[model samples]
Every structure is written in structure tokens, then in C-alpha cells.
Target: MSADTADGDGSEEAVADEETAADDAAADTYTVAVDRDACDGVFACLVRDDRFREDDDGLAGFDPETADALERSEASVQATFTDDRLEDARAAAAACPFDAITVETQ
Candidate 1:
């Protein structure tokens, strides 16, 4: 009933909310892919998502440190992630001038 007790209750609720958010983020999964044949090394995706980086061949690739699973081939690169950054991946896909980037929820 006191102001101090109310503040304590609010703080506990805030922590619980944060934990729920983290759990939701961990449950979400998605995949991002880059078509090597279509990509022109414009780096447009890099600006929207730090997870997208330039590879040794001067094309778009995924940052291994950020990706939960990464696969690279002669024609494309794909990365799977389980996090709350799906919108960031979508933004990068939408920013690609060559339509080389793709993001899919999994």
C-alpha cells in the first residue's frame, strides 16, 4: 500500500517483462540468403544490416559471428538466426538494388 512497495512491485514487473521479451526473441527463427549471381557488390545490404558483410570474393556474405548457422556456396550464401532482428534482415533484403537478398521466417 505504501509508495515504496508500489515501486518495488513495478520493478519486479519490469524485470518479468524483459525476461518474456528475451524468451520470445530466442524462440523466433529466420533465414537470410544472398544470391551471388544477382549480387553486384553494391553493399546496400551492408548499410541496413551489420550481419551482412563483404566476403573475400567482394560479394555479400553473412558475418559468422552473428549468424547461428552459415552456409556458403559458389552461387549463394545463407544464414539462419534465432533472434529478434528479423526486421533488420528484412530491411537489408529490401534495400538490395539487384534483388539478390531474401529473408524467410522459419
Candidate 2:
């Protein structure tokens, strides 16, 4: 038996292209977390990852924790990222001498 494939609009290629685009748009997302308890304020994370930076008390990553304590303490600071910045975020996590940074991907 022969396969049956037909498109009245004759835009099969266009349909396939749209599907591919959708897949790309659904790329993985990531989040970064820093534990002030584990951080040493070495600034290694700031140097290694563009997403990280130095704050008043110490190094602060993007999308820091929402808790009011985050201003005084960095125990549970967090950051979110997409495919484009996932690598940078991970690098920052790895650069933490105290292993304060944590990268979570979905």
C-alpha cells in the first residue's frame, strides 16, 4: 500500500516551518538561586557571569528573592532565565566558591 499525503492549500512547507518556529519558542527556561549563608562575597560569580553583580552587602544575582530579608540577607536570592542566558546563569552558579548559586532548568 502507498502512503497518502495531500494538502489542498499546497503550503506544506509553510506549515512545517511554523511548527519548527513554535518548537524553538518553547525552549528551556532556567532559574538561579544564591544562598547568602553559602556565599563568601568573593565576587567570583559577578566576574564569571554577566547576569550576576555586586550589591551593597555582597554579590547579587538577577531576580533576587522577594522576601524583605533579601535586602539584609541573601540566603535565598533567586533569578530566572531563558535559553539565551541559561549558560551564563549556570556559569555564575559554578563560579560560586561557597556553592551559593543554584541553577534550575525547566
Candidate 3:
């Protein structure tokens, strides 16, 4: 029943290493959103995540009919996680078919 028991010091180190790597990966990542009023519903971010969605007004606006819908539409499509990817978000804004998406950051 207890045939395999060890100090497990190496396991802790391995977990720490994994956490460090994750932090590094996320360090450059942040959060992004669309202006909705400036979006044209081109859905270029559909490949990134299902969070992005086309506006109901037919102008690529960020529809907020439901919390889940809003979250999904804003999760990946019209949003990003690059701390220094404002340029990338700008490109998305420019790529909008209706020029209705606007990205902002701090």
C-alpha cells in the first residue's frame, strides 16, 4: 500500500519551474477589447476565440444582450492579451470591415 514514498523535494521544484514558465508566458500577455461602435463585424478574431462577435445593429458593434454572449464576444475575437500589443490591436481595428472597432490600453 505504501511501497512508493519519497521526500518529494524534486516534485516541488518541478512545480515551481512550471509556475515560473507560465508567469513568463503570461507576462507579455494582458487584456484587450473593442470599441464596438467602430467594429464592422469582420470577425477576424474568430480564429483566436469565440468571444468576438458581430454587432446586432449591423455595424460590427459589441453586442451585450447577455453576460455570456458579451463575454464570449469579448473573450478572444475583438480582444487580446499582449501587454505591448497595442500595435496588434490597432491592426485589428484597421482590419475591421466597418471601421467600428477601437482598442485601448494603459
Candidate 4:
């Protein structure tokens, strides 16, 4: 039989097919980039994750260069895989009243 056709056994092949379909629909990587130029320093994202912080002036304060480096080497806000609800990420992205947080999938 072909991959597109399923047997009545509901066996490993069926599971594999479903898994493949899910993988196909899923994105390989995710990126959360803050457009600091447009950032209003809203701390909503900071409140959600300590990785985000504000400057002494109470504006969005995380170091982009540092964050970019960390994200590339270690912890990545974008590449993080979450079976948990994407609520936090989505909230962080939306919390930017200034539209600074941009989340993209690839």
C-alpha cells in the first residue's frame, strides 16, 4: 500500500503518517524580535519573563546585542518549543502597546 492509503490495522504506519502530517504543519523555528526603535518600553513582556527588563528610565531595557547573542548561543525566546499554550508568547508579542515585539515563524 502507499503512504497516502491507510490499512485497517491502525498500526505504526498510521501513527507515522499522522506524525508526519503534524510535523509538516509545524514550523521549524520561531523568532521573537523586538523592534526597539518602535518600542514604547512597556514592561508587559518583562513581567512575563525576567529575560526581559526595562532600563532605568523605565523604558524597554533588555540589551538587544546581549539578547541576540544569548539567543544564538543559549536560551532562545524564539526557538523555544512549548507544548504549553503559546499564551505567554502571544501575550508578550501583543503586550507591546507600541508594536515592538515581532514574532515570526519559519
Candidate 5:
């Protein structure tokens, strides 16, 4: 009557755990980037994704409070997020007039 008994060798539970772990990992890893050189202060990305905000230089940047990691340089800014919001980031990238935004799945 144990849980393992329902699956003989407990392989069912192990398979389920592995699938869940893979799903979690896939759901929680993505990166969003902004090419500062191409950005034109349009703020289109901000409207599509709240995580994107206006930085001091009037370009797209990530909100430190929400982004898991933020990196910046003179030419670009990149943010890593551990959340199920890849579509939101994609929308932001699509909305950019200058094609400055990019989103990649990890």
C-alpha cells in the first residue's frame, strides 16, 4: 500500500520528479537584452513589459527590483529573469521601433 507499490519500482515517481524539474528549469530561465546604440528613447518596450524601464541615459533598462540580474555597458544592457514571463519580454522586443530589444530563452 506504499506509494512505491503503485509503480512497482518507483520509476513513475522518479520520472514525474524529473519531468517537473525540467519544466521548472525551462520556465525559469530567459534573458532580455537592449541594444542601447539602436534604441531611440521610444519607450515602446516599457509599455509591453513593465520590467523594462527608462534608464538615466533615456534608453531601455531593466528594473533592478524585478530583474534577477542586470548588466550594463556603454553599448548594451542585458537582464536575466527567473520567471514565467518570456512572452512579456518577447512582446517588448516586438514593440521596439528600432528593433533594439531582444529576448532569448535559456
Candidate 6:
């Protein structure tokens, strides 16, 4: 997915960044999910956003105060934000090398 920014002549073009591509493809509908079972307790996602935190068991979990506790067995919707934070959210997904995090958009 790529975006087309208008130039002097007003033409469309494609961008290379996947994060921006995803955002451009789906502007309003997007969410991020994390699989607790698949989470390796790595703190990479936590560092990237306020959405994730270390649970009592030292595993990656949603920040209790900032987020509602999501289901652990499946893809848990962690956080929702405006377009400005979309890139940061995408970075969080990428930070999880274990592939426990997933981003949903239409």
C-alpha cells in the first residue's frame, strides 16, 4: 500500500513505508492487537507506546490504567489513537520481534 501526494502538476504517487502505506490505505479504521500467548514478555512494544505494559507475570499486557484488559487467548485490541500516532503504533507492532502483535485495518 502506498500514498499519492500531490505535486505541482497534481499527480498521484506511491510511498514506500509500510506504516504510512497502511495509514493511507485505511485512514479511519485501524486497530492493534496483541497475542498474550504468543508474547515473549519482551518489552519492545511497551517502549514504543503507552498501550503496552508488563503484566504481573512479567509478560506483555495492556496498561491497566490506560487500557481495558483485553482477552489473552486471542487477538486483544490494545489501543486506539488518531492518525498522528499511527506510525508510532506501527513501530510498536514492528518492535515485537516474536510477531505477537498485529495491526488491523481495512
For each of the candidates, the C-alpha root-mean-square deviation to the true structure, in angstroms, is: 4.3, 6.9, 9.0, 8.2, 4.6, 8.5
Which of candidates 2 and 5 is the stronger one according to TM-score? 5
- How high is each candidate's TM-score? 0.76, 0.60, 0.35, 0.47, 0.75, 0.57
- Tens digit of lDDT per residue, candidate 4, span 41-74? 6688876655566655455544454333324222
Kindly report which residue stretches of model 4 are placed more than 4 angstroms away from their true locations once superposed: 1-28, 61-87
CA lDDT, every model vs. true structure: 0.91, 0.66, 0.49, 0.56, 0.88, 0.66
Candidate 2 residue-wise lDDT, 8-77, digit = tens: 7668988899999977865557667788677777878877776566667755645343221223333666
Report the C-alpha lDDT of model 1 over 1-106, residue by residue, as the tens digit: 4555645458889888999887776656889999999999999899999989999999999889999999999999999998888888889999999999989887
Q: Per-residue CA lDDT of candidate 5, range 1-106, in tens?
A: 4564654778789989999997777576888999999999999898989988899988889899998889999999999998888889999999898999888887
Higher-ranked by TM-score: 4 or 6 = 6
Runs with alpha carbons beyond 4 Å of true place in candidate 6: 1-29, 64-83
Candidate 5 at residue 12, lDDT?
84
Backbone clash count, each prediction separately: 0, 0, 8, 2, 0, 0
Q: What would you estimate as the lDDT of candidate 4? A: 0.56
Best-performing candidate as measured by lDDT: 1
Best first by TM-score, ranked = 1, 5, 2, 6, 4, 3
Position 41, candidate 2: lDDT: 79
Give the winner by TM-score: 3 or 5.
Answer: 5
Instruction: Please say which candidate is ahead in TM-score: 3 or 6.
Output: 6
- Model 3, range 1-106, lDDT digits (tens) per residue? 7757546658877988999897665435333456554555557754333334555554343334321223334423343344444455566566656655555453
Model 2 scores a TM of 0.60
4 or 5, greater by lDDT: 5
TM-score of 5: 0.75
Estimate candidate 1's alpha-carbon lDDT, on a 0 to 1 scale.
0.91
Off by over 4 Å in 3: 1-30, 61-106
- Global Cα lDDT for candidate 5: 0.88
Q: Provide the lDDT at 70 for model 6.
A: 45
